[model samples]
Every structure is written in structure tokens, then in C-alpha cells.
Target: MTEHPDHGFLTEPEVTPEVRASYDSDVADHGYVMNLSRVWAHSPAAHDRLFELLADLARLGGLTFRQRGILVSAMASTAGDSYCALAWGGRLATEAGDAVAGSVLHHDDAGLEPADAALAAWARAVTRDANATTAEDLEPLRAAGFDDRQIFAITAFVALRRAFSLVNDALGVRPDRQLRDDASPTVREAVSFGRAPADRPS
Candidate 1:
């Protein structure tokens, strides 16, 4: 993986066998080692933990790929997490149609299904200011047909995303060139807030 000098990592951490394996898997799965993979290389166990949590969440959440992208984009954007915003925004654009994804990213829920719009708003409230959310905030979701168990799963997903965002943002980890390049223009435009893209290695 190419290293960006200004990411504020004081020492280059050793790549353990497990880390190398994970990098190999990343390249195979996504065609490149993600920037987050590089940052988490400092602690392979942490890297493993993150993905493990995501895996478990995926099984329990039961949200479609499109729904997950929408939720992740909204939550990440609300929290000013540029990395996840761009990544998931791109996925949303690809999976749910550009117009719908663009609207969500732009913070305009026009034309979105009631369920999607409600989920988007809920994600924002959960990420930016959970205390501001009241029972009223949940009424929309319940009206949109989500049950208590589903609601709990959705909140868990949001919490996990916040955890992911905190790890990357606090450490100055930047978006990878491959990731940025692969995103659609609409997705790229929507994620202009928060951290700047990572500088490439000289």
C-alpha cells in the first residue's frame, strides 16, 4: 500500500502476518488496499475487530445493501465523516439510482420513499445529536413499518458506523485514491464536507 506522509502516524507499524493477510484479502475483494486498512495496520487486532463488528452487524441488521448505503451515508455525512460518506454514497448511487442517492447525500429527501426518508432523518439525528431525538423521531420509522427489533438493529448499525468514523477521523486517515476515483461524480460532489482526501505518496 502507498503511504501518505502527512497522515500524522508517527511510526510505521510493522505488518504482521495477519495484517498482510487482511491486506491481501482487501486487494482481492476490492482491487486495492483501502486507506483504513493502512491506518489500522498499526494494530491488526483492532482492524480485525472492526471488520468483525461490521460482519456481525450485517447479519443482524437485515438492511438491504441499498438501505445500508443510505443509512451509512446519512450518518457519516451528519457526523462530518468524509471517508464513509464518499464510500457509501458511491454505493448508494450505484445500487439505488443516482437521483435517490444524490438526494440523500445533498440532505434533500425529495422523491425518496417514505421509509428511506424517515431512516435518513433518523440516522442524522442519531449521529449528530441523539439527545435531540424524541419518541416523535421514532414515530416516522414505526409508521414506515419498522418494528422495535428492527429499530434497535438500525440504531446499532449507526453506533457501529460512528465507531468506524471516529477511528479514522481522529487519526487523520484520509480517503484512498482508488476509492475517490471509483466514486461517481454525484457521490463525490455530495461528500465535500469534512476531511480532505488523503495526499498521495510522493
Candidate 2:
């Protein structure tokens, strides 16, 4: 077992087969078990299922990697979730560039194309208050060429991402050190809210 400290407010959990699988997946992708993985390992099955649903939504929405990054960064930043903001902001930087990613995190869509800008705005609206959104709020997405199905998918995607962020934030899960360290300086600077990153794993 990796000798890391407890992930969040909860104590470290025993490494059951499911938990080990979750840890292994994290290690395979990131070269270390992420702090969030440790926290989610308490319910590895639920964690896996949540990601599977996210994947399904992404696929159904026909979302490109860059689009996913834009949606996540915009939504996370709007919701004050530093963990997802840093993680997806770093990815958006890779896909779109640091300036664009930083702009999205800062809630400025000036750097994005028309469609992406609309997407980012929609994400923020959803995060800020879903009920506050009206048909008028979705007009830009329609004008930007997103069909009703795609718009529905985008809305669901933001909602699901919000749910994930809620769990991590409410449970006191700090952003992983690796996530913070790996983020571009622009992303790190933009992610000024939410729980601070965990200390480096010993």
C-alpha cells in the first residue's frame, strides 16, 4: 500500500480489491495514487460508476477533448472547485493554450471561438444557478450551432460535474499536490479559490 496521509476529513481506508483497483488506475494514469482517489476509494464502485456515466454523456454529446476541457474548466471555476479547475484548466491549456484556459478560469470567454465561448457561458450559467437559466440563456448555444440534443448533453454534463465537485468539496478533499504542481503557472494563478492543494506526498 502507498504510505500516503489521509486524503480528506476521513481517515485512510483499507485497500480492498476495489479500492486497490482504483489506486492502480490512478497510478497507471498519474504515476501516483491521487488524493481524490484515496477519498473516493471508500466507495470505489460508486466512483467508477460516476466516471462511466460521465464518459457516456461525453460520448453521447460527441464532445471533443478540447470541448470537454472547456466545459470542465468553466464549470469548475464557476462553482469554486479548485481541484477540477486545476486539473481541467491544465488540460485546457494543453488543448487551447494557457491564455485561453486562464481566460476561461477567470470567466472571460474572449479567447474562445464562438461555439466554445457559448459553451463556456452555458457552463457558468448552469453552475451559478440552473433555475435562473431560461430559453434566452440557451440562444447563444443555438446560434453557435449546437442542436437541442447537444444542448441537453452539455447541460447534463455540467450538472454531473457539479455533483462530483460537490462531493469532493463537501468532504474536505483538497486538490492533490501533483495536480497543482502539474498545472501551468497561468492555471495555478487563476485557481485562487477553494481548498488549497494537499502537501506533497512523502
Candidate 3:
């Protein structure tokens, strides 16, 4: 783990001219630039190049933005990565109009249609143990209507995000202050909204 730098752009980042234009649009759309954006930009050229690659890959995944975000969140939480879980998870919850369970913790097939459940379960299984994933796993997702290409793309995204989580944790990077702060008022109220059901039907 590299030592955390004292510079804001090093420990964090502010907008760079080349990246700012794109970041501005994203912030406008989402109401805030994600903290990852800031952190990545600390190495402007490298980060921008990598982000461009990631953007291309994420687009190839063919899931809706919400779907992609949810898969990432589930994997992060399952892997015990709180920073990734809270960061993207909170954004997902806000986007879903229900910050209560952010995509990280919410997993009920009842809420998803058959196809979505299959996709989500595939994500869970991969996160739990990639070596354990088999053709049988893809079978359910394929039967539920996901194409092979989409499944492969999802697999890629999961792998990429997991790599990202490893970096943040090894660096001992604290959760972004913005996320910690934005996690207030309405966001907090919604995050703590619901309680889990106590009984599990056997």
C-alpha cells in the first residue's frame, strides 16, 4: 500500500481540464461526481486512460446503469468491501428512489422478476466463489433471458470492480468524505429505513 499523500489531488483529486468536461456532465446528471472519480483523477493521465477503458467495457456489459451498479454493490458487500459497497451502493439507492437498502444489501428474488433474479444470483455466486461457477450457473441466467455476451460482460465488470476494491483497501484509503457527508439528511433517513425480516422460511 502506498502511503496516503498529503496533497488533495494525491490523497484525493480536484477536476483536471481534460477530465473536467466529462466529469462536469456526469456531476450534472448524477447531482454529484462520484468520489472514485476524484481519487482516480489524482493520477490524471493514467486514470483518464483507464477510465476510458472501463467506460468502454461497462458499456459493452449491456446492463442498464442501475443494473451494473447493483451487481458491483452486491459483490463488494459479499466480499466485505465496505467502501465500494457504500460508495456505489448509496448512489444506486439514491437513483432507485429508495436509499434504504442500497443495492449492496438488498437481495430478494421476490422483488425481481425471474430474469433479474437469475442475473443477480449469478453475481452472488461469482462473488462467493468464482471457481465454483459452472455452466449450470449460466444455465439459469441464460434460460431467464440473459444472452451469453451479457453474462460474459457482467463477469468482466465484476472482476474489474473487485480489483478496484483491492487497491482501495490495501492503501488503507478511508471512505470518501463526500460520501460520508452526503450520507446525511434524506440519504441517512432512507438508508436506515427498513428492518430485515426476522424469520427465514425453511
Candidate 4:
């Protein structure tokens, strides 16, 4: 097992082939092992399964990269999870724009189009309190042209993201330094809550 002083709350797990593969994938994607990946390395199978399900839901919903960014940013911000907010906000900045991504992170959907705005609103509602959401909450999504299947997929997507965020936040997993450095100034400014970025990249 490779251990780092600042790698979340749990003790580092032994580097089995599964954990090594997870780290390799992170390096391939981001040029470094992400702090979140370090934490999830404890159970690489579970991590892979969660992401697989997320991918399936995304495909079922016909989600574009931008739409996924919106859903993740909105859900993370609403749930007070700065790690995802920063990560997705940076991605959203590239797909949308810095101001728009920052706006979504701040829960100000003014910069979004009607359909995107509807998605953001739905994500927030679901993250804030799923029980508080009524059938009426689906109206805006319907008005924005989403059919029942898409709506269901979108709801499930937000819920799954919330589940991911909950675990990271509860475990004291800080956002990676690369995420903070990569995020636009607008995005950095918008993410004002939850755990801070790690002192250095993992």
C-alpha cells in the first residue's frame, strides 16, 4: 500500500491490482491520482460499479457532457460538496463558460437556457430534499421538453451523484489541488463551502 499523509480519513489500503488499476486510470485521465480515487481505492470494485451505473444512467438519459456538468454542479453545490462542485464546475466552464459554470455553482441559474435551467433546478430540488419534491417539481422539466423516461433518468443521475458526494464529504476527502488550480477564477469563487482543496496534488 502506498500511503500519503493527507489522504482523507481512512488509512490507506494495500495496493492490490484493482487499486493499482484505479490509480493508473486516474493518471491517464488527469495526470495524477485524484484524492477521491485514493479514498475509493479502498474498494475499487465498488467505485468502478458506482461509476458504471452513473455512466449507464447518463446514456439512458441521453445526457451530453454539458448536461452532465450542469447536473453534477447543481447537485454538488446544493449538497454543499465543494469537491464535485469544483471538479464539475471546471468541466462545465469548458463546455459552457466560466461565468455560466460559476453561476450554476452559486445556485444562480440566470445564465442558463430554459432547458439547462430546468435541469439545474431539478438537481437542486433533488439534492436539497428529495422528499420535498412533489409531482409539481417535474413540471418545469416537462415544460422544457423532457419526456418521462428522460426525467426519471435525470432524477436518478442526480441521486447517484448525491450519493457519491455524501461519502466523500463524510470521509473528509478534500478536493484535489489540481482541481482548484484547473478551475477558473469564477468557479473558484463560487465554491465557497465544504472541504477545502488539499495542500498539494496527490
Candidate 5:
């Protein structure tokens, strides 16, 4: 594994204007540079593209914010990514209530609407074993009233989220301290199956 980087941004000589711009937005949005953004600082182009994909999905509006959170939590939990699970699971808790968010992360889709449940299942399947998903796997989504375009958008969003999780998990980017400290107990407890922020070697 690549050792965790010491600086939040690249050294001045290596820093590009685009990188600085991205960092500036992170600070403005969250009052600090998120660990994931710092990891992406090494490649500003890739960072920009990842956020662009997120923005495109936001514009699609095929899913509500709460549904997106459930999907993200399901994917992150299935991928065994603690960083995303804590961060997005916290967001899911905020948007959908803690119990609902925790249930999604724990793979219990009991109270979710049929469509939301289908999306959650599909996200977990895609994250865990996309190759194993057959046409039958998509039937639930269709039955739940999702059109082809919506299904396409949801799949794209899941893939993009997995890309972000892969990069963070592979690079050993620890979850931000604020996320670890501030996440609800339910969210914190639900995402217990991956490398932890405290596991980073000194």
C-alpha cells in the first residue's frame, strides 16, 4: 500500500492551479480539506473528473438524496470501505433517519420502498460481484417502475461511487477525524468491516 501522504496538498513545485482550486472548494464546503480530497490532490485531473461525474448524477434527479445515501451506504458497506461507509452513512442518517441508514448499511432493506430496496440490492450486487449479476437481477428494478434511463443513471452512480471507494481504500486514505467523531453510533457501528482510520501506522 502507498504510505499515507503527510501534506494535504502536493508540494508547491508540484501543485497545479487546478489542484488548488479543488482544494479551495473542499475547504469552503466542509471547513477543511476532506481526506478523500487530499488523496485526489495528487491527480487534479482525476479529481475533477470524479466530482464532475457526481455533479452529472446530481443533475439527473432520478433518485432522491435519501435514496442516493442508501445506495451509497449499501455499496460502501459491500465494498468493505470504512471511509465511504462512515461519511456517506452519516449523510444517509441525516437524510433518512439513523435507523434507516444503519439498516441499509447492514443489508436489511425491510422498510425501504420497493424501488429504493431494488436500488440498494443492485448497488450491493454491483459492488460485490458485478460480473455475477444477470438480467434477472434487473427485474426488480423494472418492476418497481424504474425506466431504462433511470436504471442506467443509478448504475452509473454506483460505478462512480465504487471508483471513489477503490481509490481511497487502495491509497489507505483514513476517514477524516471529524467523520469518525461525528458519525452517529448507529452509522459508526454499521460500518465495522474494513481498515480503520486508527489502523494507520505511525
Candidate 6:
């Protein structure tokens, strides 16, 4: 087993009183705190910057949270980071009351559509081998109804997710309890997809 490196409680930097107070309130609203949130609180500036970018993505990205979460999960898989896929993807799925297994393994649930699946496939490709992705791969997404804005959001979401995955992996940050406890066995199995390669012979 690949053990995650632990940086203790909140791992990015020092948390300020103001940010800490706000963070408590924010996480309380959801009833759980994500490690990513702690990492951002590692530094006040880091927290501010990350929150700003995330807020902008939520407001102007044109993609729904679930769709963006799928892209994040796929990108994490392509990057060979089980921790990331299960951590974020698991929480995202839990919130929707959807099967985390389907999300982590790249399967479409009633929550996701064909177009969303195509975007996920595209995200995996771009995350793994950006240069290798041809225009043909994008045709399905375009034909399925994703406009320029959604496409842009998908691309951006994948890129940022790759960054997020690596940071969490390197720090050995622990995913929240819901990811470990609330996740179904099937979902835990799906995390292996992150360590598996598509090119491997079946």
C-alpha cells in the first residue's frame, strides 16, 4: 500500500484567526471539512486566492458542480492518484446521493449524462496525454451539446484538478472521514482505476 504522508492537522501553511473563523463557518454549513480547505488555509493568501478562483469557476464556468466533479475525478485517475479520485470524487458523489463507484470508475450514473461521460473521457486523455488528443475526440462532446464555454470549463477544471491531486498526494493529506467511512466498498474498489492504466492488456 502506498502510504500518504501526513503533515498533521492543516497542511499548507499557518492559518490566521480570521480565515480560521470563516473556515469554521463555511465547513459547518456543509457539516464536513475538506482537506483541500485546510491546505488552502495553510496560508491566508493561499486561501484567498484559491477561494477566488473557485468562486469564479462556480459563478462563470458554465458547468454544473457535478459535471466539474466528474472531470476532476477523471483527471485524478489519469494522473494515477487514487487518493485524489476517491477523496474528492467520493465526497461529490455522496453529496448527490449517487454511487461513488460509478463516478470514480468513470461510469455514468443517473446523475451524469452521455455528454458528461464524453467530457470525462476527454479529461482523462488531456490529463494523461494532452498532445495526443485529436480533434475527433472533441467532436462527440460538441455534437452532444457542450458549447465553447463548457468546453473551456472542462479544460480548465482538468488542469486545476491535476494540480490539486498532486499537491494532496505529495503532502499525504488525509481525505475527510466521509470518504473513508461513508464510501461504499465498490467505490473503494473504483479507486484502483487511478492506479490502473488504460493501455494495460485486459
Question: Which is better, 3 or 4, measured by lDDT?
Answer: 4
Q: Write the per-residue lDDT of candidate 5 for residues 1-202, one digit (tens) a residue.
A: 5454532223322557877787788788877777777667778788778878876885674688887888889999999988889888999899879888888899998888788789889999999888999999999999998877788888889999899888777766677777777799998888788766543321
Candidate 1 lDDT, 46-137, residue by residue in tens = 77787687767766767788889889999988889888988888888889988887888888998899999988999999998888889889
List residue ranges in candidate 5 displaced over 4 A.
1-13, 198-202
**lDDT by residue for model 2 (67-175), tens:** 9999999999999999999999999999889988988999888867988899899999999988899899989999988889888888898899999999888888888
Off by over 4 Å in 4: 1-4
- Model 2, 109: alpha-carbon shift in Å? 0.8
Q: Would you list the rank order by lDDT, best first? A: 4, 2, 1, 5, 6, 3
The positional error of residue 7 in candidate 3, measured at the CA in angstroms, is 9.7
CA lDDT of 135 in candidate 3?
84
Where is model 3 poorest over a 10-residue stretch in terms of lDDT?
193-202
Model 6 TM-score on a 0 to 1 scale: 0.73
- Model 4 is weakest, by summed lDDT over 10 consecutive residues, at 1-10
Off by over 4 Å in 6: 1-5, 8-15, 29-33, 95-112, 193-202
Q: Judged by TM-score, which candidate is best?
A: 4
Ranking by TM-score: 4, 2, 1, 5, 6, 3
Residue 95, candidate 6: alpha-carbon lDDT: 56
* lDDT computed for candidate 6: 0.63
> What lDDT does each candidate get?
0.82, 0.88, 0.60, 0.90, 0.80, 0.63
Candidate 3: where is the Cα deviation over 4 Å?
1-42, 99-106, 184-202
Q: Model 3 over residues 86-157: C-alpha lDDT tens digits?
A: 566667666654443332355545565566566567777888899998788788777876687877877877
Error of 4 at 17 (Å): 0.6
lDDT of 6 by residue, 1-202 (tens): 6533233234354557866775786568656555556655656565567656755665565667676667777777667776667665675666554464366455443455676667678888888888998888888789878776767766776777677677766655555545555556656666664332112111
Stretches of candidate 2 off by over 4 Å are 1-6
Global fold similarity of model 1 (TM-score): 0.91
How many clashing pairs in candidate 4? 0
